[model samples]
Target: MIFEMTTQVRVSNIEEGHKWYETLINKHPDFIPHKGFVEWELIPGCWLQVAEGELTEGNGPLRLGVTDIEGERERLIKELTIERFEIHSRPEVPVKWGTFRDPWGNRIGFFEYLDKKEEETQIKSILGTDSSRV
Candidate 1:
C-alpha cells in the first residue's frame, strides 16, 4: 500500500524557482535539504518539490483546493503577473476551477467548491480549523 507521495517540478534556475513558488504558496519552503532543491509538505506526508534541472511540459495543471478560487486567481495575477484565466464550472460539478502555469512552465491551478457546506467540511478537515474563519 502507498503510504506517502511526492511530486517534483523542474526549473532551470533554483533561486528564481524558489521565489516564484514562495509567492504562489505564500510561504518559504518547508524544507531545503540541500542546494538546488526544496520541499513543501503541502499536507502531512504529501510533498511538492521544486528542483533545479531540465524543465518539462505537460506535467501539470496540479490543481489545489481553495475556499475562493476567483479570489486566489485574482491574487495570483496581481502578485505574480500571471495571465488572467477563465474559471470554469458546471451545475452538476461541485467546484469551479482554473488552471495556469508557473514561471518554470509547470502547470498549476486552483479550485473552489461551489457548495459552502461542502467547502466548510473540506476546510475544517484539511486544515483542522473552523471553516467559518476560512
Candidate 2:
C-alpha cells in the first residue's frame, strides 16, 4: 500500500503566508499554490501539501527538501522580505540540513542532498529504510 501524508502548518497571517508561498513557487516552479495550500507532486497523482492555518505555541513548521540551499535562503530574505527567522541548531545527523522560522513563528527546515551517497543516507536516516522509498 502507498501511504502519503499531509502536513498542516499554522500561520499567524494567511496573507503573509500566501506571499511567502508565492516566493517559493516563483523559485521552484514545480510547486503549485492552491487556495491556502502549496503542493509538491513527487509522482503522478501523489503529492504533499503545505497548508496554512492557526498553530498553537511550540508547534513547528514543515521541513522541505531543496536542491539549492543558499539560493533559497537568499530569495526568502531578499525577495520575500521575511525577517525575524533563525537557523535552528541541528544535531549530528547524516543529512546536511538547516531550519528557519516563518513570519508566523513556524519552524521550517531546508535540506540539501549533497550527493547520491548523502541522499541515500538521508533516506535511510529519515524513513528508517535501507534504500530509497520515493
Candidate 3:
C-alpha cells in the first residue's frame, strides 16, 4: 500500500552537495523545506533527498533509468571528474548499468534498457505521454 517513496543521502556541506547533485540531475531541486535539506521528485512521487549531515557508506548505487548510459557516463566523467565506471550487462539482463560515487562518496548510477520498445513503454507509462507525438 505504499503510495510514495524517498531515498536520502547525506553530505558534509549542503552548498557543494546541492550544486553537484543539481549538475548530475540537470535540474534544480523540486523542494527545499529547510536550510539543510533539499528534495527532487525524480519520477512523480518518488523522491531523492540530499541533506547536510555526516557521511554514510554502503547506502545505494541509486540507479536511475536513462535513455543512454554511455552518453551519461561520459558526461559525468567530463563534468563531475568522476573516475570512469564500467557498464555491465548479461544476455538475460534487460538493461546495462554502471555505478560511481558522488563527491561525498554516495553511490549513484545510471541504467539503460536494452529494449527500446520497453524503454518507451515505461517512459509513456510514467509521463503519461505518447512518445511518437513528443
> TM-scores for all candidates?
0.92, 0.59, 0.96
lDDT of 2: 0.61
User: What is the Cα-based TM-score of model 1?
Assistant: 0.92
- Between 1 and 2, whose TM-score is larger? 1
The superposed Cα distance between candidate 3 and the true structure at residue 112, in angstroms, equals: 0.4
Q: What lDDT tens digits, residue by residue, belong to model 1 across residues 46-113?
A: 88999999999899888888877888988988999999988999989988999999888899989988
Better of 2 and 3 by TM-score: 3
Q: Could you give candidate 3's per-residue lDDT for residues 1-134 as a string of tens digits? A: 99899999999999999999998998999999999899999988899999999899888989899999999999988888999999999999999999999988999989999999999999899878986763
Evaluate model 1: give its lDDT.
0.88
- Alpha-carbon lDDT of model 3: 0.93
Candidate 3 stretches with Cα past 4 Å from truth are 132-134
lDDT (0 to 1) per candidate:
0.88, 0.61, 0.93
User: Distance (Å) between predicted and true CA of 116, model 3?
Assistant: 0.2
For residues 1-134, what per-residue lDDT tens digits would candidate 2 score against the true structure? 85665545666665666567657556332465666665655333445455667665666546676666767777778876766344343465534666777666767777776576877766666656766454
CA displacement after TM-score superposition, residue 121 of candidate 2 (Å): 11
Clash pairs (backbone) in predicted model 3:
none
RMSD, every candidate, angstroms = 1.4, 6.0, 1.2
Q: Provide the lDDT at 36 for model 2.
A: 60
Which candidate wins on lDDT? 3
